[model samples]
Target: MSKLQNVFFPLLAVVAAFIVGAIVIAAVGDDPLFVYGLFFSSVFGTIDGLSYTLFYATPLIFTGLAVALAFHCGLLNIGAEGQLQVAAFVCAWIGFTFNLPGLLLVPMCMLGAVLAGAIWAGIPGLLKARFGSHEVINTIMMNFIAAGITSYLTQYFYREPGDPILQTKHIYEQAHIARIAKLLSPLGVDLPQRLPLNLSLLIALAAAGGTYFFLWHTRWGYDLRAVGANPAAAQYGGVNVARNIVLAMCISGALAGMVAIGEVQGYRYRYYEGFSAGYGFTGIAVALLGRNHPLGIVLAALLFGALQRAGLFIDIFTDRVSKDLTVILQATIILFVGCEELFRQLKRRWAKPA
Candidate 1:
């Protein structure tokens, strides 16, 4: 019954969101059915569309897992945005500065990204452990600091000479990850040569599997969840609450940093300023809708990715409806999911003896 509810409620929320979205489309004097048909068909009807959707989903998977891990530790990690940004900068720095072979440079850049993100996130974690300062405030402040610092560093050191763009030099070919199109060529499945889907999708899948294993099948995960559920009880049971807090955030940040592998190594091959179109923030909604499970996160990320792809078609094909309708639908889904606990409480209250 609980498992059924878990699936049913999210499905309910998604359906509600679409219903509301259809109403909005009608208000705009558009044919909601036609618009939605185009939207869905564009995302799933073609191979190129599916590839693009998966490419967009890749980073969301990383960020969503990052948020889910921190939530398991009773922490809200809003700093994933900053963590990803700094990690991308470091990855780009290593990619452009090094001339090593692909085998060596790829892992080297990845390690740099992970370490940079972990360290940046560790500061707030340490503060929360030592001073009892709220991680939320500290993480939010860290985002601003990270943005300013990265911006200054990119302008001062990484930006190409006389180039107005605040971005690093293009990474060498040695650091590039092969695109999905090339990989599938051997199987005779022809994909668009320029599709952005790449090897990082595999990394995202691996991270999800690793996260599931770490949280459910490991002793450390046991300790972490114990601390999250009840810190006093966990401390009485000999779990070091403070240490777990810091450790969880570090792991979360490391996962978030994997976004760099997709953006820098896989697609753009450089650190572009403002490349993140709120993927970190959107990840909160994804995690909530997914109920913090790896399989659910994958499904939720794919939905959002499809919405993103569909929004473009809506703009081009619909006369009255704009892409903002997609934003409204996303917000509605978040709202319904966020209120789920309240609904559960109401149901319980109404069912009580009266």
Candidate 2:
């Protein structure tokens, strides 16, 4: 029943959100069916749309996993945005600074990104474990600090002289990763070279698989879950809560850091200051909508990815509807999902002794 409900309630929330979204579309003097059909058709009907949808989904998967991993340890990691940003810079830093071949340079960038994110996230974890300071507050503050530090570094050291953009020099060609279009073209598969979809999607899927195994099949995962479920009981059972807290945050940060693999090595080839369009923040919604499950996260990311892709068509084709409707729909979905928690709390209260 618990497992069924985990899936059922989320599905219910999505359905409810769409139903409400449909009403709103109609209220705004548009045909809800046309709007819905356009969104679904564009995202699913065309190869280009599908590619872009998956491309957008790639980063969301990384960020979603980051959030989910922390949730397992009873930690809310709202700092994935900052973590990814720092990691992206570090990854690009390695790529541009070192004149190594892809074999060495790629691994170095990945390691650097993972380590940088882990270190940044670990500070909050350390404080939380040592001082009982709230991870939320610490992580939130860390975001601003990360932003300031990264901004300073880019402006002072990384940015090429006379370059107006707040970005680093492009990584050398050796650090480049292959796009799906490039790989498939050799096999007579027709795909546009302009498509940003790349090998990072595979890495993201692997990360999701790795997360599932780590959380379900490993001892460390068990300890993390135990801590989350009942810290006192976990301590009684000889689990080191402090270590798990740090470990979870580090792992979460590592996953978040992987976002750079796609953005820098695979697509942009440099650290763009604003490359992320809230992928980290949107990850919280993905994690929630997915019920914090790895598989669910991927599916939810695809939904969001499709929504993102659909928005362009919505804005260009529709007369009364705007792309912001997607935001409204997402907010609606989140609200409905939140209501599930409310319902559970009410049920618990009602069942308690009067």
Candidate 2 regions with alpha-carbon error over 4 angstroms: 341-354
When superposed on Cα atoms, how far off is each prediction in RMSD? 1.9, 3.1
State in Å the error of residue 258, model 1: 0.2
lDDT (CA) for every model shown? 0.91, 0.92
- Give the alpha carbon lDDT tens digit for every residue of 294-352 in model 2: 99999999998898889899999999989999888877887888789765776689999
Taking the tens digit of each residue's C-alpha lDDT, what string does model 1 give over 207-283? 99999999999999989889888999999999999999999999999998999998999999999989997788878
Report the Cα lDDT for candidate 2.
Answer: 0.92
In TM-score terms, candidate 2 sits at 0.93
Residue 321 accuracy (lDDT) in model 1: 88
